[model samples]
Target: MNRQTLLGYVYAATGAALFSTKAIFIKLAYMERVDAPLMLALRMATSLPFFLGAVIWVVWKAKRDGKPLPPRRLWISAILAGCLGYYLSSLLDFEGLIYITAQLERLVLYTYPVMVLVIGWMFFGGRITWMSVLGSAVTYAGLLLVFLKALPEGGHDVVIGTVLVLGCALTFAIYQLLAKKFITVMGSLLFTGVALSASAVACIIHYIVVSGGVDFSASHRFYWLAFGCGIFATVLPSFLVNAGLSRVTAQSNAMISSISPIVTISLAVAVLGESFTIFDAIGSAMVIAGIAIFAVADQKRAPAKRETLPVEIEAA
Candidate 1:
């Protein structure tokens, strides 16, 4: 593989691995008596500084080079991206985890690539290849296996959690679809930075309005855990994924991101004392194999091209 392609894989893999820890961190924070809202607020608050600095540096560099700023409308689009990706999706995911195992949550969230594929096909005139369909079938079948295995123990909570997680996956898919356009205009770092900062603001506002105000009286250990989520799980992975997206097609990156659930499940077993069954192993294997097949299948989809009008400039 060329250097950029290889680096794209590396970045996507690393970002996925890091993102897997988000559930673990949120679960850990809960174990320390930190509610999801409080944990999210603190995590986003801690992450804001780094993203803000990135925005400043990029803007300053653009000015120094005598480049004109992007259209002001792009900033509004960035805020909307944050609302879809960071704020709403994460809110649903975190709240869902209150009633579900980390393993099941990861499995449900991994359904997003299928969502992306289908949504793109249905709404954007993208073609749906048989290989993609087969891959999605295999992936969902595996998830069903895992879910059925866990269902006997989880009862009603499982149903509620699944619905919430499905919402999370849907919103996340929407964000990814939009981002494929936004990133081309605003650039990844600037787009990511602006989106992150906007999400941070939205999070802070939501926390205050919902919880009355921020509470800073948590224990030091909880503080450390929250910081870990902000830095390791949030900031680092966001940049890596953006970088990967810049270098590779979203299809390739989606395949590379299959590593995330695998890592999360393994870590859940090791660290959180979650059960690991034969179903887990088989299901995980199926999901990975499906992603592999999908990646290869996408390579054959290059020739059915059709002429299309340019995207509207207002998309910026």
Candidate 2:
């Protein structure tokens, strides 16, 4: 590979690894007696200023280039998309994590690409090939393998957590679908700034409504973890992945991101003391393999179509 391509792969892999740490951070915070709403609020509040600064930078750059800003309607739509993907989806994922292992959560969320394909084929006139179908089936089967093993010990919590994470994956897929046009029009930097800012604001409002006010009584470790989640997992990884996307094809980026689940599982076992069994080994492999197959097939199927930057991957 050329220098630029190698750099892109490094950026993509690094971003994916950072993204994998989000679940670990969330789980760590939960161990500090932090509730989902409070943790989500803190994470987003910490991230808000960075995204707002990005917005300012984007606007200033556009003006310097004599380019007009996107339409007001697009701004509204981008905010709505952000709320769906980050606010609602993240809330569900956080709540779900309370009941499940981070490894399971990451594995489950790994199926979002399949959900994206199915949603597109069903509602957006996108085509699905037999390979895609086979891939999706294999992916779910692997999820079932891991999920079923969790049931006897985890009981109802596993089911609830799986459902919630699945919801997160679905909403995230929808966000990806909707945000494509906005990204195409507004550009990734501007759209991301607007959307993330909107989501952060929504998270703050939700926190106030749910908790009556922002509680700052948490341990220092909690704050540090939240800061790490916001800066490392949320913000830095975003620009890194976007930079990678600029230098590489979307297909290559997607393929490189397959490392995400593995990273999460490793962190879960090492940091959280979660168990990793032979079933987890087999199941995780299947999920990764299935996603790889699906992603390759989906990309080949629409080789001529315009590729939308998968910016949503970094939002996790």
lDDT of each: 0.78, 0.88
Best by lDDT: 2
Candidate 2 clash pair list: none
Off by over 4 Å in 1: 1-8, 245-250, 302-316
TM-score between model 2 and native: 0.97
* Top TM-score model: 2
lDDT score, residue 87, model 2? 91
Q: Worst 10-residue stretch by lDDT in candidate 2?
A: 304-313
lDDT for each residue of candidate 2 in 1-316, tens digit (9 for 90 to 100)? 8998789889988988999999999999999975888888889999999989999999998899999999999999999999998898988898889999999999999999999999998998888899999899989999999999999999999999999999999999999988888898998888898998998899889988988876656899999998899998899888888888888878888889899999999999999999999999999999999999988886787673324374654364
Clashing pairs for model 1 are: none
